[model samples]
Target: MKSNVGSVDRIIRILVGVVLIALAVTNVIGWWGWLGLIPLITGLVGFCPLYPMLGLSTCPLKKRQ
Candidate 1:
């Protein structure tokens, strides 16, 4: 993938994912917290399949070498 997720976006996703997983594991929240996996995976992969379908992109244009 061509890194569809920007740096800031990736950081946010990672933070949110960590929080959700912590909440779930600690039982501070419901199993719904597992939904955080979506962002976690997408952030790690650097590609969001839904981006094109929704016409959204946070990534900056790459500089040509």
Candidate 2:
């Protein structure tokens, strides 16, 4: 899939994901923190389904081969 997440977006997602996971593991945010997996997965994969549904894309233009 073409990348839909930009560098800044990916960074934010990773940061948020890490925080959520930490909070969950430490029992500070409860099981709800598990939901962070959504951002984590999307960030790692660089493809966000919701972005397309919302007609949003932060990725840079790609050069044609």
Candidate 3:
């Protein structure tokens, strides 16, 4: 898939996902926190499936010659 997620977006997603997972592992949150895997995978992959459906993209546009 094309990388619709930019650097900053990816970083934020990774951080949020990590936090959620950490909380889950620490038993500070419910099992739902395991859902954090979603963002983590997407961020690592640099693509968001929802972004396509929503017609959104954080990637910088390529310059045309």
Candidate 1 local lDDT, 1-65, one digit each (tens): 66688889988888898889889999889898998898888878888899988988899887999
Tens digits of per-residue lDDT, candidate 3, 1-65, equal: 88999999999999999999999999999899999999999999999999999999999999999
Q: TM-scores across all candidates?
A: 0.87, 0.89, 0.96
Candidate 2 vs. true structure, TM-score: 0.89
Report the error of model 2 at residue 44, Å: 0.8
List residue ranges in candidate 1 displaced over 4 A.
Answer: 63-65
Report every candidate's CA lDDT: 0.86, 0.91, 0.96
Candidate 3: stretches off by over 4 Å: none
Per-residue lDDT tens digits for candidate 2, residues 1-65, read: 87999999998998898889889999998999988888888988999999988999999988999
The total of clashing pairs for model 2 equals: 0
Give the least accurate 10-residue stretch of model 3, judged by summed lDDT: 1-10
- Superposition error at 7 for model 3 (Å): 0.7
